[model samples]
Target: MTTLNTHPTTAPATSAAGGGGSLRRVLWAAQILLAAFLLIGSALPKFAGQSDAVRTFTDIGWGQWLRYVTGTVEAAGAIGLVVPRLAGLAATGLIGLMGGAVLTQLLVLEPVWSLLPAVFAVVFAAVAWDRRAESRQVLRSLRRAPSRTP
Candidate 1:
């Protein structure tokens, strides 16, 4: 009987050789930092009843409740970024949230600085995309049969 090579083929290593891992780590760190910053900077002021923050939230018609909700989500997403299994999903959720923020700023606020949200959204989207292939590989490995569990 002819023996078959059962070993799986590895993807060309170069696909991830050019700074992909380091870049992905940096992106994850940056996303976590941004989430923390947003949570503290925006949330604190609203929670503290600062005049400018209150006025801005009021004028936006979204109210303080929305601020609380957003801050909580950001904090949760930031925490999730550090966990490998949850990172992809968290990044995806954060990107969606940031995209919504960008749209709100564009349509409702119409400020030139509104682009910042979109920029952040793009960064998070990149992070999610870069990690996706690896995440899939990991999932596939997990689903594979356990070798002779004794």
Candidate 2:
């Protein structure tokens, strides 16, 4: 006669890697990489060449200064995303900042290039949403009463 053990397994299965914490971490890494690329590629150029970047800034007038401000914001947000405690807030700020970028491109001028900022905005928003869900789950688990073993 064989006895069957009904106890739940304590260890997480390797196959579960794609489902929870691993998934969150992977998404965070991708978000950080994308943010860095945007900050470097567009923001850096703006600060490096005020006249050229201001041409794109248009009616805003303070174009040169605005370029510097946007560039600094992007650089800071990029750094924030990599830090464990600040990742969520960083992602949220990124989403808002990118949204403004996309709107500026659309309303100020119908440049085909405007789509790139829009895409980044959407991607960052999705990353923020995912991280928010994970945080909520953690908080919920913490608040729940521990299970009693019979």
Candidate 3:
């Protein structure tokens, strides 16, 4: 039998525009930076009841409970974004969160503030697209797992 190609069918290692390797590295750097931002800048402030975060959430008028929930989601997503297997999924989830953020800014807050989340959504979308192959593989494996029914 022929040997299977273990490597993903990604772009060439070296190309005219720098290379796929550099692209991957760039993605990794962005992921790490974004993860750190989510954890330190957003999640921690919400959890700590920092004045700015508190006031923003208070203005949202959904109660402090929503702040805790959003923080928890951001914390979990941030952690996932650094994991190779989970990065794509994390980005996918974060995209949804960012979409919610954009809508919240447009509807509840100032419309111009929506630009921030819109930008975040674009980045997360890029990360998600890059990791699509891995995400698909994970889904396939999950589909193949045996049921635990008695």
Residue 69 CA displacement from its true place in model 2, Å: 1.0
- Provide the lowest-lDDT 10-residue window in model 1: 8-17
Ranking by lDDT: 3, 1, 2
- Residue-wise lDDT of candidate 1 within 1-150, one digit each (tens)? 997764434443222326745676677678677767766775566567788777766777977787667767777777666665566667788888888787777777766757887887787777677667656765697899688956
**RMSD in angstroms, all models?**
6.6, 8.4, 3.9
- lDDT of each model, Cα atoms only? 0.69, 0.68, 0.87
Which candidate, 1 or 3, has the higher TM-score? 3
In candidate 1, stretches whose alpha carbon ends up further than 4 angstroms from where it belongs are 1-19, 133-150
TM-score of each: 0.67, 0.65, 0.84
Cα error, residue 52 of model 3, in Å, equals: 1.7
Q: How accurate is candidate 2 locally (lDDT)?
A: 0.68
